[model samples]
Target: MAKVTFKGNPITLLGNEVKVGDQAPNFTVLANDLSPVTLENSEGTTRIISVVPSLDTGVCDQQTRRFNEEAAHLEGVTILTISVDLPFAQKRWCGAAGIDKVQTLSDHRDLSFGEAYGVVIKELRLLARAVFVIDKNNKITYVEYVSEATNHPNYDAAIEAAKKA
Candidate 1:
């Protein structure tokens, strides 16, 4: 597992650590309307999955908005921001932020995405900061597990990986 810290305090992460070249794990996360969405549903397109602890925080908000802005310029790429926040909150944040390019999904119900991606913060019941890029064939091309929960990811590297995919 990747070592993580939040505000200078160490935290435990539960789940297998995912790395580049591994097959992306399939998991069910809820859409804004509480409908189930899984990795199997987006098989043909290159995907960038942005995992954050919550959307209401400063870092998480900026991370999602950054991807949302970049999504507008990237053709044939699907960007998803996953968080433990409720579906209602995710929807509201997206609307208030004017984030139309990226789809914000909630992992509150089951933490399937959190476990599958190895991002769940054991102490807080939240997802640690991370980013993943999966190719059209479902193989992971890039993985970024931010060392600190309150930090940002390598947006350029993740975006470049998706472009190459």
Candidate 2:
């Protein structure tokens, strides 16, 4: 597992850490309408999976917004923001923030996505900040487990990886 911290405090993360070139794990998450969304749903398209603890926080909000903005320029790439926030809360936040380009998914129910991606913060029942770029072939092209949960990810590196994928 990748070492991560939230607000400078260490926290346990559960699950096998993923690496580049590995097959992307399939996990079910809830869409804004509470519909189940799995990794297979976006097959045949490049993906930018943005993982955050919650969308209600400042850094998470900004991170999602940044990806939403980048989505417009990345043709053929599907940007997804996954968090432990409830689907209802994610929908509300997306509406208020005008985050249309980036699709927000919730892992609150089963933490499927969180566990599969190795971002599940055991202590807080939240996800650690991370980013994953999976190619259309379902192979991970890039993976970043943000060392600091509250810090931003490497946007440029992720975007570039998505472009190549």
Candidate 3:
């Protein structure tokens, strides 16, 4: 288990993290259209999994919005914002926030996304703030798991890594 904190309080998380050059774990998630989306199922696209705790929080919201804006200028890379939020809620949040570039996928059904991605907060129903850049073959290239809950990641570096993929 990975020891992390929620608002400075202790919380444990599953430890199935994918490392550099490791193939990303396969899982099913629900898209806004209620269709199942799987990272391993896609072909010919580099995927950026922007795993966030929840869209309701400030940092998570900012990350999603930033990725959405940055994705517009990139090519051949699909930015997916993965969260435990329900598909409807995610869609509403994105629409209200004017986020149209990144696709939000929910882990509400099976919670497998957290397990698969190793970001799920085991104590509370939350996910950790993480960024993973997967190449066209689904190999994890860059990964950042924020130790603190309040901090935002290096936006410029992540975008550059995604661009290089």
Model 1, range 1-165, lDDT digits (tens) per residue? 888899999999988789999999999999999999999878899999999999999999999999999998899999999999999999999999999999998999999999998999999999999999999999999999999888899999999999999
Model 1 gets an lDDT of 0.93
Tens digits of lDDT, candidate 2, 15-71: 879999999999999999999999999998999999988899999999999999999
Q: Which candidate has the highest lDDT of all?
A: 2
User: What ranking of all candidate models by lDDT puts the best one first?
Assistant: 2, 1, 3
TM-score of each: 0.98, 0.99, 0.93
Q: Give the distance in Å from residue 18's predicted Cα in candidate 2 to where it truly belongs.
A: 0.2
Give the C-alpha lDDT of model 2: 0.94
Each model's lDDT = 0.93, 0.94, 0.84
User: Lowest summed lDDT over 10 consecutive residues: which window, candidate 3?
Assistant: 1-10
Ranking by TM-score: 2, 1, 3
Clashing residue pairs, backbone N/CA/C < 3 A, model 3:
none
- Stretches of candidate 2 off by over 4 Å are none
* Model 1 stretches astray by more than 4 angstroms: none
Residues 36-114 of candidate 3 have per-residue lDDT tens digits of 9887655588888898988988999999999988888889889989998989999899889998889999988887878
By lDDT, the better pick of 1 and 2 is 2
